[model samples]
Target: MKHQPHDAPPGDPDSALAGEAEGYLLARAHHDQARREAEDLCARMPWLTAAQAEDVARHYTRKRIDLTRQMLLSTVERASQLRQEYETRYAALRRDLLKLHAAGVCAALICLGGAGALASLLSR
Candidate 1:
């Protein structure tokens, strides 16, 4: 794959995908660098053939894949932690709201009783 960095400037119509485009360019550069190194190694060592160079590239690719997988797993773990914290805060707010509602109901009932008592005294 061929990719070049900074093809689209910031604020360009395609800038929204700049991060992904940059990643692709970086990955391509890394692969090309590795391939060149592998070729040089094969050239320096007469016994090592093209097949050995291919194997070296394959090994590096596998290492990169493993590292990406680890990063993704850690991200998932972080997301789970955030979700738990949000749930705890939501539950606390719900409890506080319920307490406030109960207090309001009690206050209304006390006022109604006081009004009824005042009316009876006035009638007598």
Candidate 2:
């Protein structure tokens, strides 16, 4: 058996580690992209002093990160809503199917009872 870390919970440490690693990689990629965008913005206006360029880069990076965060939050909220709706619809459909099945069974039993009664009357 493989060993688990004492601080970790009972299941699948590998997946947890993978998720953390993926998050760090994405954060790094976003930072790199923001840095490149900031550089491009600074390059467009060559007249600014060093301090002014630095300020612009800082402001641009902050705004970009905030916008990305807001978009991710909105996407997560929408996904949650869709999951709830699909689950409710699935439950309703299952209930309808069960009701139909029960009705079919009852109909079959009634037909069998009528046939048995008819056979008894014919014999008499």
Candidate 3:
């Protein structure tokens, strides 16, 4: 028997939406943190000694930026994975819908053909 739409065994709408929303929020937060860190690095650079100031400032900014990039990358990767999963599900649903439509068409044709045959036999 074909599975019913309402009877989704798993990956229901609420859970999926929640997961996506969470990922988006995380990415946003990570981006904000990174921006703040960059600003701090710039503001503090002047106080640093000339001997190793540039290097130290660069290191601080680089570390924060790298971590932010990583966080955003992970968020993007998760979102990509979610999109792929949804695409796959939609493809399967489309296939099933087409099959159902074809079956209905075949049944109608069969019924008409049978009726025509019966009428011919009666006329004979």
Candidate 4:
């Protein structure tokens, strides 16, 4: 599941509902994936007793879930860091662009003023 950053302001009911729904879906998907992995592991070692297999499946599932949670948290953290870095860079670029435009306007005005002064002197 792709994680999306929430855009709604705090205290918005719709955003809260959407967040809850997304959380539910993510949890369900993770559980389903862990179950499949556990089953696959059990299938590979069919000689084990039923009780032992069950125990092994439970342990494997727990570990898999924990690992997946850690990885997801790591990914989310990195995504946040990247977003901050990008936003900062974008702001700096916008500021530079504004400065360049202001400089160009000033240069154009200076050239026009110089031409006007030269024209007045020639007329005199």
Higher TM-score: candidate 1 or 4? 4
Candidate 3 on 1-124: residue-level lDDT in tens? 2212454545577656666777678867866676676557666767656656656656766687687678867987898899999999999999999999999999999999999999999999
lDDT of 2 at 102: 100
Please write out the lDDT profile of model 1 over residues 74-121, one tens digit for every residue.
987898899899999999999999999999999999999999999999
Q: TM per model?
A: 0.57, 0.84, 0.53, 0.84
lDDT string, candidate 4, 1-124, tens digits: 3334467677777777787889999899989889888988998998998998889999998999899889989998999899999999999999999999999999999999999999999999
Global lDDT of each candidate: 0.74, 0.87, 0.74, 0.88
Highest-scoring model, lDDT: 4
Ten contiguous residues minimizing lDDT sum, candidate 1: 1-10
Error of 1 at 106 (Å): 1.0
Error of 2 at 90 (Å): 0.7
lDDT of 4 at 113: 100
Residue-pair clashes, model 3: 0
Worst 10 residues of 4 by lDDT: 1-10
Candidate 3 Cα RMSD after full superposition onto the native fold (Å) = 10.5
Q: Give candidate 3's TM-score.
A: 0.53
